[model samples]
Target: MRIDARRRAGLRAGGVAAAAVLALTLAAPATAGDATDHGRGGQDRTYSFTVMGTSDLHGNALNWDYFKDAEYDDSAHNDVGLAKISTLVDQVRADRGARNTLLVDAGDTIQGTSLAYYYAKVAPITEGGEHPMAAAMNAIGYDAAALGNHEFNYGIPLLRTFEKQLDFPLLGANATSVRTGRPAFAPYVIETLHPRGGKPVRVGILGLTNPGVAIWDKANVEGQMQFGGLVETAKRYVPEMRRKGADVVIVSAHSGADTSSSYGDTLPFPENAATLVAEQVPGIDAILVGHAHQEIAERVVTNTATGRPVVLSEPLRWGMRLSVFDVDLSFHRGRWSVEGVDAQVLNANTVPEDPQIVELLADEQATVVDYVNSVIGTSTEAMSAATARYEDTAALDFINHVQAQAVQAELTGADAALPVLSIAAPFNREAAIPAGEVSVRDVAGLYIYDNTLLGIKLTGAQVKAYLEKSAEYFKPVTAAGTYPASALTNAPTATAPNGTPDYNYDVMRGLDAPLTYDVDLGQPVGSRITGLAYDGVPVGDAQEFVIAINNYRQSGGGNFPGVTTAPVLVNRQVEIRQLLIDWVTAQQVIDPATFTATNPDWRLTWMGEPLTVTP
Candidate 1:
């Protein structure tokens, strides 16, 4: 098959030709299986090929500025850029030549950083144009890629624009257009590589995006398309690929594995759709997985029907690592099959950056840097992003306070009088806001996900349950204590079975009510909240009270139990980050002193011994 012109641009730009003759020298000698079977019984020959894959690029086209630059002391964090990624890509290819290599991206390549922000806000690709990301990928030579949910972050029109710019086909068997009922993009692509004295071998590649895209990016994608189940979609596509003369079939899945189950005692094991896809799809061979930002190197079972070996490999997100899988291919009876496969994780820290790739990405990098650095707002005190320990943190408190005020004003109106309790997750603790200036970037440090504020009504019982759920992040130090620590670390060893740690025990701010309970780390969830009372009265199962939280939690974004089904009082279109920016801008001076966890009465003690409360 002829390579698309745009797909071949990278090679062309470097003045390389496929038929160019070079000195006949082998970097490494071929093994005994050096002769091609060629649809005839002959000595088996192994063809060594390297597959480079990346997932969750998240628009990190440059090195992450964890501090968002000095001017924006806003404990905001940035990440390694795509330019840096280009450097890594070149090094991998240089280490392994064309005859033995394939470069691929698992997904989530379009959205995340300032470049994405700029692409969405300033110069959208849809208005008769191309996205910077697409250009970058083209220059880098991506052989094949799958659809990440974030690719739809800008909707179908923009997605089409981005896809049109891609020299390589954007593959997705699961994602389909509602209007057409056919695959939204090409179901798969095949590449043929010719070796000395042998016919070309066809490698079939199919793609699967997370079915949850319907919910995750619902606002952007719902009206335009529908995502089918991963297993069903793969079953239909894989056989078609095989029938289309494919020798070796590889799946590029924009999904992730379940690492929490293996880690043990860890709460909130974010469900990765990749694991389910791998387990269900009756695939033919290897799988390239992403979307979870997980770092893994192992073969997983994709389907029992085919008993196929699915290789789920992912490097760290944001250009931190490059995953390389070397697969040996052999042809038998006119069909290609995977002989053996091995994987490796290439850390960006170890390799020298590639200069040509760096130069190609320079303009895009500078554009994004300038955009992020443009001052949007400022803070007088160091606004922190630390959520390591669940003591009331100044930054966390500030976020809650801002959200609370916004909710109160909207729900009760400016003249109404009522105390508003706002709930937030302490997931954004990557950067500690040292005492200094705070900027819009610093506000980003307070929260990462672009979640919006959500208002809901709950009863005293629901409030207690919510608090209990938060408190689940912590576990009592003893049968009579409340001190909480890393549940994973404190978990009991085999000899100390009764000392099991509670990984889901996290304390929630707000609500001062009485509770009585016997410490049972292993008790069922509903049973664990026994004798719960709010404001000196037993919480009525049906009594409703107003509650405020982010849209992510309300929409089951974090997989929090009961949250997905919660009643919505209001869906504030304003994003939490924007609210924070507005709040800071309105104040003109943000004092860390004013920020204190108002609900200090919510205390924890282990075995009746007070644990140091540090936010």
Candidate 2:
């Protein structure tokens, strides 16, 4: 059989390749698992191989940015999409020898772009349609992949369907069924490599997803699946992989290599624990880190258990980079032993997108472009989110308006009589809707994330506290004066030492009435909120109100106050982007005069006086 056939057979059988087939392996010692001489085993031999990794592909199959409705580019001029990464991978394979290399991914593959959303919602792949991601990945010939938290965004049924369409195993050792407490997905996969004349080497790959999934996607995974700590899960599975005759072990962890949790003790496990797994788990050789969206060429951690070095690498998200891990092994005493491991990341912008990938998904790409450009409504006046972060803009108010209406309509029982408010953030600084014809992309650009809307109850005092916490986004000003927007926004706090992200700074607005407040930058971090009121009246501490929030914030993301424990009032599993689109389709017109607050809903203040802020 051919080498590709043998590899597929090994993957399908989930074990070592047949000995007879190993003898017939392609005649090349330069490649992985190929010995210098085709002699029978009995002497020491060495082999080298490469593992190419990617994470957070996020439904990018091409170099086009769906939100921009144009080819993707930025001030950095960095390229995105799997097509570019494929070109880089092909170069690595040619340089390292095809059989000597393997391809894998950390996670976040099935969601992010319009291409992914179309197949998932518009013309679901579950209805006998092939998903573009599965097609692109299969054509690239991936050996294995891990699960990302976003994989559950569309719920389990869609995720399962996407999983079934893949040719490779999707490993998730820590994701377990709630009922039986057993693994809900494949725990790990053992891949065997045959040297020309040496003993076969078995490589174990373990996958651990983010435990935050239980909180972020509670509406989808509340009673179906549960996630465990990465370190604990690695400890349990690494020893088992060794017992199963794994010569080397690699972990594809969908967690960051840091020591912090957005949920803050909501679960016993830390949200970003890849470094902990490397330090505490003895058998790990290398790890491909994901979920942080940061670029890390290589990070080495010494395992406390064995004092051995384990290498970790995280290629930045959205296919901007590809991580390459090089491994060297030696055969001795009738077994293979890992000698060394190192890793580095390759920039996808260094090469043009592979023509094969472009050709394969050409039709799918066109469909998404056409869908996003299709007219959904018309705008009476243009609205820009340029200054939404520091000022109240019509764009954000429109979002809150739609979200508040959705929650208010869904309320039942006593919650129905309570006034409703909604929270929104400046997700994109460049998002804007041009006057006249509006398209799907126009609305989607305003809301870049795939967040679902949810309604939770909070007291008047809790609302003020939440706003106070959000006020932490602004640096303390000594006096009222004109200041650069950048200087005042994204203030650093204990939870966000690097500075708070704009998405974490939420702005609250009422549905029928304005929930107004002033952010006193002159005040300290915890006491910046003042003039808190509902409908021009001071809010009482005991007054209760329902607030519309996104699934991420409501589920402890950003470590916002009182939201996680707040009583959930509505959860329809509706994507906020979809709701915006549906609302636009129904309204057929987006007029800022109708939604924009007559007076500013919020303002920057210093000692009860308003201040001017500039971008």
Clash count of each predicted structure: 36, 3
The 10-residue segment with the lowest total lDDT in model 2: 15-24
* Candidate 1 residue-wise lDDT at 321: 75
Residue-wise C-alpha lDDT for candidate 2, range 13-93, written one tens digit per residue = 552211101111233345444655423554677888888899989888899988778888877888999889889988887
Q: Give the TM-score of candidate 2.
A: 0.80
Q: How do the residues 412-463 of candidate 1 rate in per-residue lDDT, one tens digit apiece?
A: 4432333345676665557555454555566666666656676666656666
Best by lDDT: 2
What do the candidate models score in CA lDDT, each in turn? 0.60, 0.85
Which runs in model 1 stand beyond 4 Å of their true positions?
1-44, 70-81, 127-130, 259-276, 378-398, 401-421, 425-438, 448-459, 465-541, 544-615
Which pairs clash inside model 2? 32-100, 33-195, 35-196
